[model samples]
Target: MLIVRIPAEGIEDFRAYEDAVLPLLPEFNGRLERRLRNPDGTIEMHIISFASDADFENYRNDPRRITQVRLLEKSSAKLELLSMANVP
Candidate 1:
């Protein structure tokens, strides 16, 4: 999962950053499970799933993803990446 906090001022840029990167996920065997936005409009959360650790790593290291990350970093005040698993 990815948790992102951005000042209201950065929202526009963040949307642009998101649009550019989301298309790259399928190539790495990943998919966005959900996206949540705070009612107050101050934060966003993205839940992402991947076929395997190898797929996640491939997504992390992909050049296109790296470029999008740079844009994300520039637009957000805080960003976090978390690993999650579904319990049986």
Candidate 2:
């Protein structure tokens, strides 16, 4: 599976980003696998798994996804896609 990792900075932006992106996952043939927040106020993480590599690519290239990335960058933060790796 392909994993998308978003590390959010602000709580408001984090929630807003989530709201904007969550619904589109299924459209891109992906699923929201998990969301984790650091109690120490470091980062809010989201893990999205896609059905296929092409689906992941579609999601990565989606205009809305680009917009969200820009939004995060504008907020002086960013997101990352943890390349395919073995997970237990």
Candidate 3:
């Protein structure tokens, strides 16, 4: 299992980023399984769950996603992408 945290700044910022990202979502071949917005306004985090390393890699390598991320980075005061292994 793969986990990633995307800091979106706030709910509005998350929504705006989601709106832009939605268009390119299909190209990922359904790799990005779930995306949840943190309920509290503290971190403004986006929790993403991916199936495997290959899937994660595919999404990361997509030029469209890369461009989208670059654009989002400029929009937010802080954007952090943290990769982790799922443990349970």
By lDDT, who's the top model here? 1
Best by TM-score: 1
TM-score of each: 0.86, 0.69, 0.50
lDDT value, candidate 2, whole model: 0.66
Clashing pairs in 2: none
Which segments of candidate 1 are over 4 A away from where they belong? none
Model 1 vs truth, CA RMSD:
1.5
In model 2, state the lDDT of residue 66.
77
lDDT of 2 by residue, 35-77 (tens): 7766753465666778889998898789987788655554454
Stretches of candidate 3 exceeding 4 Å from the true structure: 1-15, 22-42, 85-87
lDDT of 3 by residue, 1-88 (tens): 2222444444455456657765564565443445544465434445565556676678778776666665455445355677766679
Name the weakest run of 10 consecutive residues (lDDT summed) in model 2: 1-10
Using lDDT, rank the candidates from best to worst: 1, 2, 3
Error of 1 at 69 (Å): 2.8
